[model samples]
Target: MANTNWAGNIEYFPTDFHQPSSTEEVQDLVSRATSVKVIGTRHSFNHIGSPTEVFISSRNLSRVVSIDRIEGSVWVQAGITYGELSLVLDSEGLALKNMASLPHISVGGAIATATHGSGFQNQCLSSQALALKFVLADGSLLEVDKHADPELFQACVVHLGAIGALVEVKLALVPRFEIAQSVFLNVKFESAVNQLMEILSLGYSVSLFTQWKGDCLDQIWVKRLPSEPSPDRFLNGIGASKAQQKVHPILDVDPVNCTDQLDIPGPSFDRLPHFKFDFTPSHGEELQSEYLIPQPYAQDALRALHAHQSAFDKHLLISEIRTIAADSALMSPFCAVDAMGIHFTWKKDWHSVKAILPLVESVLSQYQPKPHWGKLWAMKPKQVAQSYPGLSEFKKTIQKYDPNKKFQNPFLKELFED
Candidate 1:
């Protein structure tokens, strides 16, 4: 098995990385491990939920357990990725409400971190779960549902793979829909930020990509329902025009791996995501960090970023700005407040990144930004606790279920420790 994560940054092949074929096997393996952490797809850029002592993976547990079309939900093993789930759900005339830009990430990992897709109305992928089933530290199963166990559900839905090894999830679904994809070139930075929400709301999903040094945004990708209007007001901007060809988010990379664009309509599964599911990501080695600020402060935050363009210009590969709707997940960064995510995909230079990240955090401090759990962050532990008011309650709740702290990791330990 690969020693490092998807980004090839964190080396995490534990002495005992168990890949159990069934939930019972997971139970037995987890019960024997003195300490453990649950990993799925290993997509996280940081070591937040990576193994601390022993590790158990749901890799072999990928299977569709059941589908409740009547209730608009489908149950599946936690190992399944959004790419895999989308193909299955779309074929059955159902679909996910939203998905992160990259679909190869496991649904379990995405939710655990409250990872989101772009949209004015759609919440993070975690909110789609109607219920989840986990194998506790003692090899016992604990199932929580949104309707029946609301408090427990809110706490565990963003579990961070700490309380237990999640084995299965029942996700809420929507009727299958199509999205027409388009990209606008060189949108003015002034107009973009001045009317940020307006442009973002132009589509069911919208994303602005840039390198932070230019007067114009590199590109504005929009995924809209076919019946929606084109972004005419945006095109009216000086030097802005709709992309004549499909383009990659990174200015110099190949577009062959990206989804179909140029206003072509395709399955929501295909168009909603930036990359094609089948392509082995040649994204090359990269590191990521994100900050989620409350909606009211987003414009000011962007202007702050604009002031510090020099901080990122040399090492930054690209940055994606997007908006996510608020969700009820207790530990979610966007919990109960609509937020704008400012994500930076930096070149693999931890020496530079490690030094510069604190500076970036300092700039966004006024906004009280909440960093993504799976990405790089430099916020103080006390600040993290303050950002998520329920984090202390969350730690207590999970500790009640995982008394021995078998699933604890150093990343989580630092934040929650007294």
Candidate 2:
């Protein structure tokens, strides 16, 4: 049987798909192969992690190396999932600063692709990275820290699995805390956009959801610290009311898999992410595309998406608006400053969706939206690179690390060449 990605959008036919339990085995594979890539959890929707010929999977490398309580950091194998890491951390009375909506993704995969969680102050998951151990093209293990090599580290953290195979990652940690999640309903789209920042600032982490076919938004999820006062009726002036029962991000779907809501307090790990650790995130059968635009142009981008409502309304299940603070990773969508992500979750129909992406791109073109590296997109490579200010430096760094191009896959070749 052929191996496929989590979304089943891409299938792999590699010369070998080796599962290496130790870094030495991974190095051996890299040293012997003409071309190779590192596949972690296979969460990526694109071909970034699937090398055409040879590739190594880190699934067997799942282990928690150590936790430095004094330094407030946790080191774990690259294949460890955030869900698994969180449980380990929580048991020790520690936690990550933030996490992506779905915790099923591997730590290395999420960091390499710049996956982020929601919050005006919380940076992308990669920002918490203190140091990393990766196997270089020469089959040598190299470790880099933020302090010793700022420039290379900045470029390396989000390497897109192009430079090397990450073996271990060290991340900053925080004292465990409690969080409460609440959902508000029926907020007018105009009002939400007009006070978008205000709404986002309502809680520690916030997410706004809508279908784009109506005049008002469908729901707004506000996740907050236990000490923060819960809003019984959020956006009241804008006609938003507290949801009577549990609700899914996309309307009418089962909320059983979602995390606790209704302002009930729970462990930060269980509350920060939208979905539960064991449950399938999103609809389990959908295609996703997201664009992170400059925060200042959020209103403009929202207006642009709203303009094409008729085209996407039928094919779209829902759209989510989330925020992330500025980060230093070169290729990260929010590298320069804080960013607003406009994400679309569509009904699994790529034909219709692909046709509309260009129009969606055209509308938000003025704002220079940076497409998520791991999701689906139709933007030209040049257009995609234009949004990242440090693309040139990132390219140079890639050349330095993988000069033999052993890690270069067709996706990276087109991305860097085009």
Candidate 3:
């Protein structure tokens, strides 16, 4: 099989992989099974924590159930990958506002943890849900949204498979557009942030990619609405500068040749993810932890990270910084606050990563950072509850939907006790 996941960290396989073709079958299986955990692409770094008789794989359920262009919405089976969805939406002249680095992750998986792309105007993928259809433990189908079941809707948006098995998702869409990407080397850190803010203000969407060890300051990708301009016009000033160029075409080139080349054209999805350049392939395996802090604290947080670079360099891959606007999804990291995401990819040494995590957590805690639900975190359930303003209300909704804890894994159970 081809290599999977940019992280290459997941390896455990369940005793059995159950693939149900329809929501009714999913419901029936859940009701009859003694214990089960939904698996989506298995892209997560943590194990599914099944410790159960069976594991549910949504892969076979892949399908686009419905689309309403006028309403800018799509109803798709939970197993559909972002790449597939993007292509499908493109054919219909519709697109998601933002998508994370790799397009291969499943929609269900991405939303379960609120995966996001960088842009001040963008929100987590879960925030795009207009509605969700889930299979309850009792073999019933529940369609929840802001209007249908307000509380449950909010709680389940980023539910982490605790409430029920997500069968399908209804996502909001935007008109399809083209993206222009570029890479800039040796940019002063402070100046880069200013330029990033400026680009984010004017572009439809933007991303800033940086490496910790090098002088590389930014690899930017900006998506422009198709109605705006042609290649020649768009490339005039922004395109010519070596410091403000694109990224896609050079992805397959040699790492040495990959330096400082600017102004490339490619799809929006390709430009957003980090594994684009093949040069750093065996940079060695790594562990990642990311936290979303309010934008006002971004500068301070970056400075703190800089202060620890000497200690960090021993086992760090790169530290990434990105921004996003706030949304109200109950479990969303960016919920209710404009935020900046700071991510750390540590060298594969577990001991080193574990040792450094607490220190990083301390700095983030001072800024009141919110952990990404799917990634490794040091916070206890109480800390998690305290971090999200709507935790109490969300738990109330969770109780109504999954009182029996059928979907509860050890990680979730510890974080959310009945």
Candidate 4:
């Protein structure tokens, strides 16, 4: 049995692994399996796709069914990877407005959890989904869009594998453009936060990566409109001698493969999405926990985390802060709130992460944080309901699509059940 995902952290030996070549095949599998779950690239950190009796994958179903330049949309099989889509869209002068940290992740997998990137101006990837075609548990095909079954469209946008088997997705596209990124290092933490807001207001996207050691803020990556030359003029003025000078030679080195350098000049797809660098390779196995608190609470959350730096640094490789414009997708962590995401990449200590999660949750609870669907979370159903304003409406829609709970896993069962 092939394992799932890059992390290879979550795996199971399924009774059967079925790769469906067509929509009919998917329907048939769903109809026949006593218990089944769909898998897409297996990028999810959780076991949402785990099933004992049967596991279905859409990897072989990948195909660009249609592209409408006039409508600025593309219809593609759900299994296509963001890396593949980036190349396709590059050729046509079109691209997705935003994407997560990795291009290897499947589009379906990303949309399932409302995967997003660091961009105050950009919405979660799910918000770009115009329509979805799913194979229900009963072997019936259902098409949902804004105009047809709007509630289902919203719910299925971030279904967490509890709705149905996704077949095809219709995504809105943007005119492809170029972005220039410059990294700043050694900025003060408080000053960096202020600069982050400024960069976000002026740029298309901005990200803050820190080691949580309380020494320095480390690096800031800012992507702005291609037209803006001297985008960092003010930043340069403040630290003119250092502004023009690149900090670490290590900054240019790609953290992952360590061979490729981080430089891109042409399309947004190549420039934005995931950083070409992977910073933590030998940091050992790691557990991730991210919470989306309203943008207003960003400083408060950062302060709380900083206060616990001694404890946090004991097991953390880094903690990243990113922002996303509010979205309407039902299960999205930042649903309907302009959110600031605080993510912790803890040193492969699952026990440590498990131990500290409740404390972390309590600290952010004042801001009404919503947990990322695919990551480790400590919130109960009541807390989840309180976090998402449209919870009742979303649950009602799920009932219409998967009333019998055939799509549920142990995790989801606990969340959706009383």
| lDDT of model number 3 | 0.68
lDDT by residue (186-239, candidate 3, tens digit) is 455555554445644445555554555433354444444444343333323343
List, residue by residue over 189-267, the lDDT tens digit for candidate 2: 8988898998998989999999997687889999999787666554776789988799889778899989999999999
TM-score for each prediction? 0.98, 0.97, 0.85, 0.91
Clashes in each model (backbone N, CA, C under 3 Å)?
0, 0, 8, 2
Against the true structure, candidate 1 reaches a TM-score of 0.98
Worst 10 residues of 1 by lDDT: 231-240
In model 3, how large is the Cα lDDT of residue 296? 85
Give the least accurate 10-residue stretch of model 2, judged by summed lDDT: 278-287
lDDT at 63 for candidate 4? 86
lDDT of 2 at 218: 89
**Model 3: residue 132 alpha-carbon error in angstroms:** 0.3
- Reference-based lDDT, each prediction: 0.87, 0.87, 0.68, 0.74
Clashing pairs in 3: 101-273, 181-246, 182-245, 182-246, 183-245, 245-263, 246-263, 246-264
Local accuracy of candidate 1 as per-residue lDDT tens digits, 82-194: 99999999889889989899888888888889989999998999999999999999999999999998988998899888778899999999999999998888877888888
**Which runs of model 4 end up more than 4 angstroms from their true locations?**
237-264, 276-284
Which candidate, 2 or 3, would have the higher lDDT against the true structure? Answer: 2
- Alpha carbon lDDT of residue 258, candidate 1? 94
| RMSD each, Å | 1.3, 1.5, 4.5, 3.2
